[model samples]
Target: MNRHLLYAALDAAERGWAVLPLRPGDKRPALHGEDVCPGIGDCAGGHRKWEERATIDPDRIHRAWGDLPFNVGIATGPSGLVVVDLDMPKRKSSTDTPNGVTTFTALCERAGQAVPATRTVRTASGGVHLYFTAPSGVRLCNTAGRLGKRIDTRAWGGYIVAPGSLTPMGAYAVVNDLPPAPLPEWLSARLTARQASRALMTAPSAVRASRYAAAGLNAETASVRHAPEGERNATLLRAARALGRFIAWGDLPREQVEEALQWAGEQAGLSPRSCEATIRSGLNWSIARNGQRRVA
Candidate 1:
């Protein structure tokens, strides 16, 4: 019956963390996918995603885990937790690049702050997850590498595989027993900036747009968003420079171009500060170089 696993689910529920059953020895949810939903029990009204279906009920937990050795998952948003994921290097043989831990430590140093002491978990792959209480009145979403290289965060619209889960790599384990700390202010500020940047991009601008300009902006932003991890910054810079000519010729507003590119860069996993700097540099260079070109 995997009594230990049942206890793990109850323990998380006791702490108010919404628990879900993961596939046995895997991190994916054990529940049926939306396409295969029976539209009965929980979905009588409509299909509910894993986040909405996650529950802290002891009875449900017992019913789900009492029959199989399924792993456990914690829906971070429902739990009011933001987990910073410091991932291991994708290629163990590649020692040239810094791991998530190294980059995150450097990020804290640059911000003039110490790493927050929080509830810590060691993932099956030897990565670290640092849990923090979400700040009041802010809805932070999942971000991939927005903090630093190989550093990701899960909040709203995201989940974390809880300790007591097993995978091909190894068992997830709790390394630090400390309760989650309130999210550090410096880190919170950065994440808030990310949110604000996205908001600015979506808010309608007063600038009139030509069909050509709109198409160009959409295409360039897509390129930035889908750029390979190693080339994200370069792609953002190239996109900004390419679109700066539209602004230079007065077909697009400077603010609109910058905001769109900024949002795209952030989505591509570049740090917000770095994205802003790169976009600015690219746009300025393009504007200056093309200032005298005549558009007929």
Candidate 2:
């Protein structure tokens, strides 16, 4: 690896945000060793391996740059960084290279929208890491997982592709400075409207599961109860719709659910319509039983 390039990347990263360097073998560099510094490490000396060497002063960087835009890190090579969307279905064996690359590209495109400044760095695994400068205060969640399952990206020990992490590969550093398009103002508004509609229509359905559970009915019993005609059909339809909505928007934080619903409503150009009260009630009950708070 090019030590000079690594130093330069660390220096550039220090100019904006703090960086945590990962040695070739270390996994949890931050948690391990005696060294509490962000940049330097002593992995070669086992006894003194974790001794803190030095740390980049965030205050000093801020004073020098006057409010830098992002935080970043550098990896020795492409293998150092890995990309996983955690949205894709997992395979029983072998890696899904095509699908993985597609998802990675999509994430890069999305990041490009928020931070116009982006650079692509190659990984040792022959994959690419898309680097971008994240805007202030925007943090990413659920990043270390497969496109659908729990894919741990930390195994590679490179930069994360989320909003807060910087994109760096091997000796090369990707810098994104161009401004991307802003999200539409009406998006959140539309989601709010849809949420309101769903709230009203699904009110009754929300409590259905709770009602069954209250009556000492297990899942099997509840299924039998809904086997009848008329009300049963409506109940099934409501359940399906509610589940679909959840699947479509469940990844968003609960706080953002209302806004997302409103946005969906606007994009579809449809008036918000609530699902049946039975469905809402059943969903509520299910959520409660699962020890989860309902977002919509």
Candidate 3:
């Protein structure tokens, strides 16, 4: 019902930014939307496929904001935008920034480059969101401090709470008037490396996935490999246990280990939620057991 917010959403959409509505003052979607979310978050928008319904049409935007005051959510990936979210320190110190700044600074140093001044947003939490144009064929995933502690990337599958959105805490506001700059090659390489690492780590399982069909393995292996709902968690946990042992010995990145387990789970038809929870629980148990053994 707030015309100001409505116009803000419309203006963003006009600039080819795919937009969606968020619950008033909250980060979650305003409604149960389509399975369009590429952003990885712990809780689903409405606990299910919420981003699928995000849109750029002014008419749909109107309908969304007509009922209650809503926050503007910009879909990053769909619009070819990537945002570097930097959680700046609350205490104003020229040299003091969150770990993200340090990480980014190190990255720039290694790459012989400096961070570009791009379309920037000042978040309610006193953080900054640096917008960039995503490169073609780059599978940029939403990360929580993966790039650097407290630094994250929101790309083709992620969304950013837009400026002019208000929360009880504060509001998001645009500080820079520039358009999103092209993603620097160095940063692109880092994001691409993440995808590459995932793919490489899962390559063996992917091959096994192919073997599961046609020339499939015997019953026990097949059952574990291609798990169904009831047996899914146990099967994945067993696998995660192995991965955790490997990881404990410095044999793998936990992310890739997770991908390997999910790769098998999907082959067996487990949902995303099922895959995540099973892997998390299994990995924790594995780590704990390993720790106890060392202590003993």
Q: Which tens-of-lDDT digit does each residue in 1-296 have in candidate 3? A: 48989988998898898888888889766654224433444234443333445678888888878878899999887778889988765456556544566678787787789878889888888778899988987667565455776676777556888999998769999999798899988788887876566455424333223332212212223455666435666877777775565455444556656665654564454543466678888888877776532442
Residue range 132-154, candidate 1, lDDT tens digits: 99999999977766788789888
> Looking at model 1, which ten-residue stretch has the lowest summed lDDT?
198-207
RMSD of each: 8.0, 16.6, 8.0
Give stretches of model 2 more than 4 Å off: 5-9, 30-55, 58-97, 104-117, 142-296
Q: Choose the strongest candidate by lDDT.
A: 1
> lDDT value for candidate 3?
0.69
User: What TM-scores do the predictions have?
Assistant: 0.72, 0.32, 0.69
Which number leads on TM-score?
A: 1
Q: Per-residue lDDT of 153-234 in model 2, one digit per residue for the tens?
A: 2211233322222233323233343332222223223323433543343222332233422232122224423343224434
lDDT measured at residue 203 in model 3 versus the true structure, 0 to 100: 41
Give the RMSD in angstroms, all C-alphas superposed, for model 2: 16.6
Candidate 1 local lDDT, residue 293: 48
